[model samples]
Target: MKFALVLVVIIGVVSLVSTILVANRVEAEYSKSVKRNLTNLTLMYVLLFLVLSVGIVWYIVGVR
Candidate 1:
């Protein structure tokens, strides 16, 4: 359980950093449509991460 939680956190952090870097890079060259897409994609990723993290914590606590 500890390992799984840690792994999830690490993956989430890495994904977030990578996303931010890519978004910044693309923002410079892209127009409004592309920027909007990136923004949507980022929001989805954030929502997914939050859901997964909450589920995992809830499961752990319930198990205990």
Candidate 2:
């Protein structure tokens, strides 16, 4: 179904982003620069994901 496909795609992307970008930093030293960079990246990615999800849902709903 379209809903299932969309859910899978969104989850897949989120999982990939978390695994690739966020998980690797857990073992890293949290110096000021590294912490700031990580925080910024996390915020950017979260906002991007939210905007993308909203856009996808809007487009899908409007298409019908």
Candidate 3:
């Protein structure tokens, strides 16, 4: 569980950094529609990470 939590955090951070990079690149090189889609996808990934983190914390607390 500790490992899972750490992994999730690392992945979340990496995803966030990548999203920022991609967003900047897309905005500069692509259309508004593409940027909008990318924004939505990034939001989904952020929400997923948040939910997973919460679940892991809840599990860890309940076990104790």
Over 4 Å off in model 3, which ranges?
Answer: 1-3, 27-29
Model 2, span 7-47: residue lDDT tens: 96788678657755664576556566666766777777778
Against the hidden true structure, what lDDT does model 1 obtain? 0.80
lDDT, candidate 3, 1-64, per-residue tens = 6687788788888987887777677545576777787778888987897798788878888999
TM per prediction: 0.72, 0.57, 0.68
List of clashing residue pairs for candidate 3? none
| Cα lDDT computed for each candidate against the true fold | 0.80, 0.71, 0.79
Which parts of model 2 have CA positions greater than 4 angstroms off?
1-30
Error of 2 at 39 (Å): 0.2
Query: Which residue pairs collide in model 2, if any?
Result: none
What lDDT tens digits, residue by residue, belong to model 1 across residues 1-64? 7888889889888887787677676644575766787788889888998899799879888999
State which candidate, 2 or 3, has the greater TM-score.
Answer: 3
| Model number with the top TM-score | 1
In model 1, what lDDT does residue 8 have?
Answer: 81
